[model samples]
Target: MDRPVNALSKAIRRRLGPSRLRDVLHGVPLGHPLHPAMAMVSAGCWIASAVLDVTRSDPRASRTLIATGVGMALPTATAGLADWSTLHREQQRVGFVHAIMNVTATGLYTGSLLMRMAGRERTGRALAFTGLGAVSVGAYLGGHMAYRQAAGANHAESVSHLVPLGWHDLCSLKDLPNGRPVRRRLGYIELFVLRLGDGVSVLADGCSHLAGPLHQGRVTVEDGDPCIVCPWHSSVFRISDGSVVHGPATAKQPAFRTRLRQDGVVQVRPAD
Candidate 1:
């Protein structure tokens, strides 16, 4: 399962690299994952079709709504696949099963739509109800991947509250080599430190999208500002203020204020 699943995901990811279509699917401009949001379209249409069936409302309208749901499912699932390709192994495994369930539900709903068009009202309603049940199961798994596993959540959300107030000693300013990114620890918190000329920039070591270690990522200059690109998902963050330069990451990276003490020791504190 892992082999086939990983191969599919990797192929999709490789094909999608930094394209505008991929950005749109990922909801980069909207600052959120688009999959769950767009899914509401198909789900709402299906529920309305069920209500029409129960109320014995115009049969023609009910059939139209069912067909509408089938049309909507295509784009919704496409958006979902875009995000699914970037998930971690655990999330991807669960997502694979979830995708299978959704595909099954869509097929059932399509059959129901065709039955209604053929004037087989009783059969259509039964298949529609069964499809809804399949959707429920798929939604449950989707929620687990999101809430339980924290698939698309901000990994560095706790940094501001966890670090102590005021300046905490990091290391001597001389220790960090020029034009290099290094990791430093303060208690349990880890920070990514970069030295460029006379200035030092520090940010939370973890990527906000999936907690990819920022220290392991490649640093590059984009438009004259230094940024780090996450190795896992390629989300980029500006080092100066930790703002997103590019993303699947909707949240800003937690940054810190750096200053030198009297003895030439460097220290950092949470940025306002």
Candidate 2:
């Protein structure tokens, strides 16, 4: 099952290779996942539409909510494309279902808005109700993607729970040159270690945005703070804390505490 799925994903990737559409959806410039942000905006509009339905009968309010809904759809579409482009077949199937449901809901809302503008009040209300139901179903599917599939959730966070206490040798302090990151493995955990003059920093090797290798990233100073610029997407993270300095990544990288043992060995443990 997994083999076939992998083949399918590879085919999809080949078909969509190096596309501007994929880049926009992936939020490549932001260095983080974009779906969650777009989802929040869509959800907000839905809530506002629900409120207007209950609190007022004015066509103007309905039109306003519908326009906002339409506006939110653009980012939602981008996010869906971004997520789908990189997904395995099983996840992609689920994502496709989610996308269909959400897009249908958007269309329904658009029709409702048009109906309301044309003074077809009852038909518009009916369409709005249908759209609301579809959006709810789409939201449920999105939750499944995040919680069950771990889509858009930070994979690096998984290591924080499993990393052993106290310092574990990563590499010799000399192995990492100043302003360059080195990759090392501790058990199943991969880490990116940076030597910054007198200090050192460690973060999970995978980027929070797209699992891009952080070891190949470049170190620079931003606003008087040390940060690593991801080689793949250029997402920047503070060296001291792993906080995102810029996004497509809303979540921070999993940081690790570093030390130099008396034997001059470099060590790291999950940061407290």
Candidate 3:
């Protein structure tokens, strides 16, 4: 099951590529993932519909609300499916289950809508309640994916606090070859260090997309500027300032200020 789903997701992502539509679906311009916001809208409408189902005197108003809720769910599912395609295998596995539950809920609500239209009020209400249960379970799984697995989160968000303010010794500068990414440690923090000419650029080793090790990635030039392309997801970050050059990632990698100590040791600190 996971294999087929994984294959389909990868194929979908490959087909998506980089486009205005995909960016809009990703909520890049909005500075967040679009799926959750759309999901909330659909869920709110459904909640209102469920309340009206229980407390309303007129079945017309309840049915109208239910229909509206169902309408909102279409866009919500579209946004979710767009995000789902970009996820890693483990995340995709969980998200696939989440999607299945949501589809189940949607199917149930569709049946409920048909029943209501046919004047089967009690049967419609029963089906709507059952759909609500599916939504609840789906919501739980979605929460787990978001918070527990850190799906759609900036994996490098913690780097700012984790890296100390003052320069800390890492290793000898002579050991770092030009045009190669090296892993260095400043106390407990791991950093991706790259040398180009007289300058050394350092960033948090973790990819912002899914914590892919940036040091393991290939360093390449994009439009005459050095960039690190994450091995896991191909998220590209500028080596100069950690800005995202290309991404499934929306957050910038945490860059560091590098300096050479008098003893020829390389030291680094949090960037301004």
Candidate 4:
């Protein structure tokens, strides 16, 4: 599977690399992965068709639903593939099988639609029911990946909750290098600290998207505002406020407010 999956992954990267289209597909604009939301359309249509079938409703309505679902599969699958390509190998393996099941289900529904048009109503209905079963399995795997595996979850949401509600000493201002990002321990949570001239900025070291270390990432200026690009997956967040400048990461990195004491010790507390 690695050979083919790796090849397909490379192809997808080549096509969507660093483009707004890739960001759209990745749900960067939406602040969550688009695949799960897009999938609901196709899945809903098919499920509705199944309900119509169970009730022995109008064949035409069922046929239309099946066709609609099949038509929507292409875009839905494309969005899923885009996210799948960036996931870890374990998640990718599950996603690969999930995609196969959906493809098989789509094929079955397409055949069902064609058969109905050819006047073989019974065979078409049978195929459609089978397709629903296949899609159900695919949906189950999708849920497993999302809920159990946490493939697309925000990994840094626990920062504020985990940190005690008060100012904590970070480091002395002189220990930090000017204009360079560094990691510092603040109780249990790691912090990304950057000092420029007399001012200091701090953000959670773990990225909100996938726990990628922001301190290890490179800094760049976007629209004249400083931003940090995740070294793991290239998620970009504004340094000043930890807002997402670009994603794959929907949630902002937990930003911290900082102050310098008269003794030049840096102190930090979770920003409101």
Return the top candidate by lDDT.
4
Instruction: Give the TM-score comparing model 3 with the true structure, all chains together.
Output: 0.86
lDDT of 4: 0.88
**Runs in model 1 lying further than 4 Å from the true structure:** none
For candidate 1, the 10 contiguous residues with the lowest summed lDDT are 243-252
For candidate 3, give the lDDT of residue 189: 79
* Shift in Å, residue 157, candidate 1: 2.0
TM-score winner between 2 and 4, please give it: 4
Better of 1 and 3 by lDDT: 1
RMSD per model, one decimal: 1.9, 6.0, 2.6, 1.4
Model 4 lDDT, residue 80, Cα: 87
Candidate 3 clashing pairs? none
Q: How do the residues 96-158 of candidate 1 rate in per-residue lDDT, one tens digit apiece?
A: 999998899899999998888888989999999999998888999999999999987778775
- Cand. 2 Cα-lDDT: 0.76
TM-score of each: 0.92, 0.65, 0.86, 0.95
Candidate 2 C-alpha error for residue 80, in Å: 6.8
Candidate 4: give the clashing pairs: none
Instruction: Give a tens-digit lDDT track for model 3, residues 185-212.
Output: 8777789999887688999998988899
Angstrom error at residue 257, model 4: 1.3
Q: Give the TM-score of candidate 2.
A: 0.65
Tell me model 3's lDDT, rounded to 2 decimals.
Answer: 0.84
Error of 3 at 208 (Å): 1.9
Model 4 regions more than 4 Å off? none
User: What ranges in model 3 sit over 4 Å off?
Assistant: 57-61, 221-224, 260-265
Ten residues in a row with the worst lDDT in model 2?
Answer: 16-25
